[model samples]
Target: MTMEHGRAAGTTRKPKVVFVLGATATGKSKLAVAIAKRFDGEVVNADKIQVHAGAPVITNKVTEEDMAGVPHHLLGVLPADAEFTAEDFRRKAGRAVARVLAAGRLPVVAGGSNTYIEELVDRDNAAFRERYDALFVWTDAEPEVLDWYVALRVDDMVARGLVNEARAVFVPDDADYTRGVRRAIGLPEMHGYLLAEREGGAGEEELLALLARAVGEIKENTCRLARAQAGKIRRLSGLEGWDVRRVDVTPVFACMKDGGAACHQETWRKLVWEPCQEMVRSFLEAPGCRPCSSIRPARR
Candidate 1:
């Protein structure tokens, strides 16, 4: 049956799902629990870390006492060393959502892992998927070697494309011997430079030295770009209708830590509990918000 947004047949409206996301040390769990209590919702774990088992103390898994009888799914269910991927989370989380709907309860996903949340929402479009894969390849390469290789490839590709006719023809010399043969056969110039640096031959040491300097320059440039982007984000965040706020919950967590619980209760309070509670409360108290008829108490 098609579900209408909090409306009976012939009533016009659509219900919206609620999502709460933030960085670590934000109180997501507490907020989710509180929201669940108020709205008769079931909380779903969206953070990747909270899925591991056997280390609630280390991972700050929610305790029964902390849950206060509210239902939380997908927490402390996996072994710590076991690998869990986004695809795994997506399948499991989708099932959890379906179950919540089947039970006529609100499904609230709360967590700090932005990537996990994005996957839960199925926002992985082709462009993002391609970019994600590219990033994985990029990060796996040695920084200095990768930078030099990338630079050379980009330059060569641009030259081949005839985007710039004035560019010098890339030649593989004895100094560029590392992967010069590969580069000569149409490998990216960047890869060739890296290969030469790594292989180190007669005068390859000089080439390697040049590559090191180039890498340093690249790092500095990258940092500058990041800072500039951050500044832009800050500026844009201050624009109209932006409700961005950064809260420091360190003191609250510190208190929980100093209070001397068996583990990092402060992390739980800050990362899970508080943030979840706030999000729940905000949605519940929003103007025109009403009790969702879809919400039903889960059978114990």
Candidate 2:
């Protein structure tokens, strides 16, 4: 079956991976299992914790029974003390994805580590630069105009009492000046700005507080968008009978805090099963080209 964004249509490539990420204690494994079962997908581990062989309990590796007939890869493959880097993960994950494609099954990567997902989706292309140019056409305008606009925005913020004028300095066309405004205004470059500031003698406490607020805002916005996107993807893909949902399962681990062999089944249901089910059902009902899972035909 073929799928297309606009005019172009071709075989629907199925490197379709769903990554589940959240903090420690999130029920990432259970969710991966449910998604795998529903979509005929396989789970690929992205958690650094679950990679260690001896610390199954400590790392919370998915058990055999929990797999529910779904295939899982990369779990318990590393020793606890061995260092694993993002580069290592990206290489291994790429291979796993290829293998999953060869086996005619979907590959689902799940974990709480954000670094894993970021690295997996990182694109080395000019698309980002093009996007930036398109969004800010006047970015290359006269330095005076750019400076005036920046100063205006900063001055407005100052009037609103959001910044301390005594510490803030405005320099025309300066990268630091632009970065500072971006941070003060709760923009995406805030993290980079904060890091730079910290290295440049910013007080730890003040920087931390600013970072906390920025992070909270980012999380709230991200969660809102994720919930909406998850729902939309489920609805659109379900009608076509192709499972395309991924979840972030972090709460499951939290429920295990007291420490015991007993599992937090409720957390699993709420954080993993429910979302997976929703997506699976939606995909099964949506209208679209089916994913190609044939082993007979090889890509040229």
Candidate 3:
């Protein structure tokens, strides 16, 4: 068996990994980029779907423009049809983190996938696992606001050729979701509409109505996924192994909607970035050890 060590003995300190985790549309990727920019960090994806090559539309990939010149790894690298397990993420993310640190950069694991993040952080190789100074940052929003964001995002996906994206990977009604991209949230939700449209039995009006209904279902399903993610984070935050901090982004979004990008950035810096910045700064200041959680999640 081959074992990889994260750091050499007598090295100044083991590398630290900053994980920005949350449900879809919670600005996890944006905040990760902010931290990476401030701390000279690179992003290693923990979202299973985004790791797959192609399907950027379906997986909601962070655009290169939005990345603000920071490097991102483990994104769109795997084949779209490939089966990626948590263990797979562990191996790839570990190497990504090591390489980032080797180049004198911090590693930011940013994504909405709780399982992949947990596996990479805690369940990976035992030798290197102990050496990692890991910090978990969770982004959250109000339930209604999350629902609205998800619904709007689904609408945007439709505008961005979501139907075509679904058609490329739609499966049979009885198809098992475990295979290929069938497991993706939007694909399964839009499968019926794609199939009906391809079959050419439904009239134009009926097809349009079906498409509308499918989009609605996708929004509803996405909200459910968000709730499930919250439950996962709740359990994860209670664990004693890793330092966890949760940031509620509802106010930021509201400011953005009412004000603009400038206002959003300011609010983000105040609420999200500064706290994470303090954590990263403290971790770098006290190298070779995990930073204690200084900010706790808001009490519900």
Q: Would you estimate the TM-scores of all the predictions?
A: 0.44, 0.45, 0.87
lDDT per residue as tens, model 3, 1-300: 111122335665556778898888999899899888887888998888888876678788998899999999988887777898888888888888889888877888899889887787667445445877777788888888888778878888889988898787665656566654566778777767778887899999988998888888888888999999888887888765656677788888788768888998899888777777786666656643443454565343
Question: Quick one: best TM-score, which candidate?
Answer: 3
Worst 10-residue lDDT window, candidate 2: 132-141
| Cα-based lDDT at residue 49, candidate 3 | 81
Candidate 1 residue lDDT tens string, 9-84: 5644333345544333234566667656666778788767677654343234667998999888888787544567
Q: C-alpha displacement of 160 in model 2, angstroms?
A: 55
Q: After superposition, how far is residue 137 of candidate 2 from its true place, in Å?
A: 34
Candidate 3 wrongly placed segments (more than 4 Å)? 1-12, 124-129, 171-176, 257-262, 287-300
The sequence of per-residue lDDT tens digits that candidate 2 reaches over residues 1-300 is 222111124533223445554333334565567766766778888765466564243234577888888887877786534666777777787788668756766567776444554454453342222221100000011223323333333334335533222123322234342321222223442444345463677677777676556545544543443344334333433332222323333344444433322564676566556645554433333434332231111111
Error of 1 at 23 (Å): 2.2
Which lDDT values do the candidates have, in the order given?
0.46, 0.46, 0.78
